[model samples]
Target: MSEPAVSVARYLATTTAEGPGLRTAIWVQGCSIRCAGCFNPHLFPTEGGVRWSPADLAARVLAEPSTGLTLLGGEPFEQAEALAEVARQVRAGGRSVLTFSGFTHAALRRAAAAGRPGVAGLLAATDLLIAGPFRRDRLDHERPWVGSTNQEFVVLDDRFPDLADWRPGALDRVQVDVDRAGTVSVNGWLDTDRLDALLADL
Candidate 1:
């Protein structure tokens, strides 16, 4: 049997800002939620991202010296099966998995209970899940790991025990990365005004 293919918009082999430690971040390509104030609007389109098999993606993520894996959007649950496989492989290598989703945990629980394909597997493979739609009105600048106040950090496993007390302030919270193609990207939570200033300086 062959592994499912994942539509990948972008990926960073290593980054400290995505989670507790150095982590590999994989941003999937499509999102149906289309929240009003999405930071990565470019990823809304359901097409145009490069495709990678689960095995290949797992190898790429594990190739680097990362403490864990961070799954970002367009929406990780949108391609649950592929991401599940990737997470499985990463965890098998003794690394934890963190995932961001536009769907709430309750909704995901219902989906999993209803037997949605890949939902249970993905949740099972994840250690921590940041779940909720990004609400512009409820944007939270103080939270280090989430975009909005409504988002909840649901720890599915005990792998990331430190997150219970981890709190990152403005300094050293955001990470800026420029790929070989000269595409500059930012990750982590920041105040809207501060984010504007940071982008203006760039």
Candidate 2:
């Protein structure tokens, strides 16, 4: 059977702000759990992004010289099967995969137990998973990548051994890039006040 097309909202070749090291990032399109105060509200609709087959997406990511791949919203698990294939291929090529999701780990486990193959596949392929919804009221100031204190960081396998030693209070880094046409794109975690200040000066 042919693989389903992956709706890609954004693709960055290399960025340190997304994960543990310089990594290729793919922001998927469409989100079922539209959390209040979500950062990428524009990505909530499924119809906006360009679609690519899993093989093609994996190839594009592998061509990059980054150390790993980071999968971000709309929600990786929503398009789990295709993204799982991409993650498997990336790992086969000797790179790690980090995935973010709005669903809690327990909920994901329940889905998997109910025979959701895609969810199982994606979970198996992911090396690190930042799970849980974005809670605006519970902003996380101490963690490295997560936005809320409710999110759980799960190290799925041995890929990121050093992650176990990772502690809170690590500073979050943001990246601002301007394309040739002067389109500015920003990623990473930042508080509302600081982000407003940064964007105001831009």
Looking at model 1, residue 51 earns an lDDT score of: 96
lDDT of 1 at 49: 88
Residue-level lDDT tens digits of model 1 in 4-109: 7999998888888887878898999999999998988999988978999999999988898998999998999989988999999999998999999999999999
Query: Which residue window of length 10 is worst by lDDT in model 2?
Result: 162-171
Worst 10 residues of 1 by lDDT: 163-172
Q: After superposition, how far is residue 200 of candidate 2 from its true place, in Å?
A: 1.3
TM-score, candidate number 2: 0.96
lDDT of 2 by residue, 50-151 (tens): 999999899999999998999998998999988899999999998989999999999999999998869999999998889999999999988888899999
Angstrom error at residue 55, model 1:
1.0
For candidate 2, list the clashing residue pairs, or say none.
none
Total clashing pairs in model 1: 0
